[model samples]
Target: MAERQGIGEPRFERERQDDAQASISWLPRRLDADAAEPKLRRFGAERFEPARLSLWAMAIGRDPERPLAWLLAADHLPRALLIAGALDPRPRQDEEALVLDGGRQPTQAQFERWWLWERLARPKRWSLRVQPATLRAVALPLWLGYSRGRSGAGQERKTRLIVLSGLSGEALGALKPAVLAGLRERTKAQTDAFRSGVPEGTPEPG
Candidate 1:
């Protein structure tokens, strides 16, 4: 049986994507006892819970030592707004150019559907920052304080995931560093993979 202590960060090294995936045939492995586990001192809302943490633990727990290859076919999308350097650079309407040319993207709604997509993005688009070492995820926006960690002008963004695991203050303090380190390493590898497409089966970290 796994130890009852907090989780620990698994050993990890970088490897090619295909080789990594080849090692993991089915699901991501559960974490080993060596992995650091943070204590949960408090609760924010009802959504973040041990179940969520367990899910996260299960997802990357596989081969904690191998480098992480984040599959981002749908992640880190640019905002629909035409902000200068925001998510997407396209104009508010996806068809400004097309309309100018008297045409549009092949759609049945005459571009209304595309417009609707852009409309809905604003409310749901909560920018999130990936926590390192601990393998925990955090939202970056202050408005999202309720769901993610609370952050404002002066506050450093900490994780709001402690409640999920029901850890105490001491456990939270102890687990902070481990979680940050793991998350940072994971995020770094993921960012690298996002920049360059990895092979199908990259090895996962322990």
Candidate 2:
């Protein structure tokens, strides 16, 4: 009789596509679908007409159950596009920052947001030369799941993008504003950190 493989056994060979999507698990929190549609539509129309207006989102607190909304720029733009997902240990490195193996082949939407966010993050090095309105043309959605601090049961930690079994829009709406605000602040801080070339007052990247 043949011996059966254990649960931990490698079942299928890891395909590139499979690995690409796997990185999305880093931010597995369900995006605000209801808000996403309207925000994308409204912003799509007002991306330009002005400059300096940008998008922001951030996470906060120890073991945060959800993201906090810190800032929403008054600037508007085209609809934000949803991409497959963002890869881990960002800044893909190849001959010179090439996409990594098993990395998600970003759609057109992903390309836009990726370019914009990266520019925003390193404004000193990168340029915000594009018109504000055109910024909307490239915003992409990233669904992610990640864990901070300790793991295992009874762990003092936070898990993002968990599947809510039966939460209604109304229930989620109650917390939307705060969450969005927190996310905005977090986003801004991230960009600023990159600009400062010292995230959280840490050493500059070499």
Candidate 3:
């Protein structure tokens, strides 16, 4: 069983440099969702603005729960315009001097081939990004066994793009707020850690 860790503020530390700065000790809990238990897996994703957020369908960064949340809210976007974040592990350096490296893929084909396919098949040490919005956009309704009714947000669309089961509108409201908050916290933590050039304090795996 995964060790039961209490819910609390993520670990934080301050470096004694030219000035004092605080950073959260953060690392993704589960990287591969397909290999791990459902509850423990995390999706590596950030930037949750409307239709602009795209996550690795399987990348679990500091937070394991963001991917599914993103997938659920993804249909709100235009197309494959989701901002996919790459999760290349930074090299170890003196905690005070370590900087978060820029994770950018040069081309979309490269990102699609290397990050999505090869990584999925081989399970090697690599990172990029993924998205389930389109897949989920269709899959979720079918799985739930409910077609989108013509009344609320999903009205008039061919995909019947609305919830039909869980929430009041058959939607997922609760999950979004919590997941969005988690993403925000993760972003802040990463930025602070990088700015301080401190190796991350501790892994906050869920």
Candidate 4:
């Protein structure tokens, strides 16, 4: 008998930094650091961290040439958010500094099953096909705010995270689960590598 493979296996590239940065599209950030700081302050966050999430875009329905596109979070836990129309991502400009990219790349099969079909319930009205060549990966900007607060007097203060959209500076409560899952996975990987001894060329965790 053959062994069974998990559907969520990390078969795709682990982290495509240089290649993705060069080729992949990026959603423009309308809120700069100066403008975002005040927004974070309102949430009582002492400091903020900038990050990026990799999203998968594909045209679904009967026509592969449809103008509208679907955007999938494509992280550890996939979430689907439908864009109104076609994807028109802007290139990262020179002034934009690099940020940590969270989320794993999903295989075409996994993307279709987990992110698309599962959510849409395999609508019979539309003819959906996964065209590997048509799949495009884009980066979405995010802001993570760190705030310290105490449950009650005499209790130790604990830090909390607030996620916001770097594009519109709006709170991203729905994406909290995906963000937390990605952070936990990254932490576990670093911890395991540390226990096994860090490699010479391996970069230190920031």
* Positional deviation of residue 189's Cα in model 1 after best superposition, in angstroms: 0.6
Using TM-score, give the best candidate's number.
4
Candidate 1 TM-score versus the reference = 0.24
RMSD per prediction, one decimal?
23.3, 21.8, 20.3, 7.1
Ranking by TM-score: 4, 1, 3, 2
Residue by residue across 16-103, what tens digits does model 2's lDDT show?
A: 2243333322222233545433433332321111001112222111222322211111112122212221211232112211111111
The whole-model C-alpha lDDT of candidate 4 against the native structure comes to 0.64
Q: Candidate 2, 165: how far from true, in Å?
A: 11
- lDDT of all predictions, in order shown? 0.25, 0.28, 0.27, 0.64
Encode model 3's per-residue lDDT on 1-206: one tens digit a residue.
00112256234311111011111122222222232222111221211111112121233223443442221222221222221343322222232211221111122233344344434664642343443111111111110111333466855733222111111112333233323443455589877876677456855445
lDDT of 4 by residue, 113-188 (tens): 6445544664652455544445666777888889997678888888888888877788877677767776776688
Off by over 4 Å in 1: 1-42, 49-171, 198-206
lDDT of 2 at 173: 25
The C-alpha stretches of model 3 lying farther than 4 A from their native spots are 1-3, 6-170, 198-206
